[model samples]
Target: MHRVGLTGGIAAGKSTVAARLRRLGAAVIDHDVLAREVVAPGSSGLEAVAEAFGQEVVTVLGELDRAALGAQVFADPMARERLNAIVHPLVTEAAREREAAAVADGSTVVVHDIPLLVETGQAGHFDELVVVDAPPELRVQRLVASRGLTETQAWDRLAAQADDEARIAVADVVLDGSGAVSELEDQVDALWAVWADRHPAGSAR
Candidate 1:
């Protein structure tokens, strides 16, 4: 199977590309979804998070209070690193299982939708890396408009991850995310064509 890594900055339209890839028949493994699943109410991930960050990060209903936890980590680099140390391994293992299942089910293309692939030093794991890119200012504008983050909060979020230059350095393909949705979709279509050609269905890996 062809393992493709999809990543981008916060609010840089990576989700849009991932959705298009899903619609176009790629087996898309969303790490963000797995990240949440690993930390569900009864999970060891939740227990570990509570052990490190405190019980205040867990909700009354036994779910993780993501916003509460995010507030603590986003402001402190060491705290963020601690959280990643707790969560990244779980997410990676879960993603591996999902990809294996997809390949066993005859999926030729497995797209891993990872927001922090670059930060995690996982660019080499994928057969090809696609970086969805937009200007920092535009991403900040998007965060403020859609997510209700303050300007400072948006900037802080961006600062927590690798810069565009760093991401681009490892990318095999870069999709522009500063344009309209249709434009992004077009880029994904072109990308899907290449992936499909490289790993056609029912062909040998």
Candidate 2:
């Protein structure tokens, strides 16, 4: 299996690339989705989070109070690290299970769509590292204009992630995300053409 690590900063259009790849044939394991699942109400992941961040981070309905935790972590580096410590391992285990399933199902390309791929020191784990590049200023503008985030909030989120330089330094493939959606899709299609040719049966369609 070709294990590809896909990552980009906030608003960098990484999702667009991942979706296109998914349509082409790659099985994508989205870490953000796993992050939420691992910490679901009754799971041990949630228990670990509650133990570390306190019960206030969990709501009356036994659900994670995401907003509360977001506020805490965004404002304090220590709190963010504590949360990462509690969540990252669980997410990794879940991701491994999903990857195993994908491989067993005869997937030739398995993409791990991880936002913090570089920050978590996972660049070496993949057969290829795909980083969707976009200027931070553009991303900040996008976050404010489309996501309803205040400029300060957008910048804060950007500040919390791995820098562009670090991600670029380790990337095996770089997709430009500073263009239109169609352009990005074209790039994904080009990559998929190669991947499909590599293992023809991987493309079921």
| TM-score per candidate | 0.96, 0.96
lDDT at residue 22 of model 2 (Cα atoms):
89
Q: What is the C-alpha RMSD of each candidate to the true structure, in Å?
A: 1.9, 1.2
List residue ranges in candidate 1 displaced over 4 A: 202-205
Report the C-alpha lDDT of model 1 over 1-205, residue by residue, as the tens digit: 6788999999999999999888888889999999999999999999999999999999999999999999999889999999999999999999989999998887888899999999898999998899999999999999999999999999999999999999999999999999999999999998777766766771332
Query: Whose lDDT is greatest here?
Result: 1
CA lDDT of every candidate:
0.92, 0.92
Q: How accurate is candidate 1 locally (lDDT)?
A: 0.92
RMSD of 2: 1.2
Question: Distance (Å) between predicted and true CA of 177, model 1?
Answer: 0.5
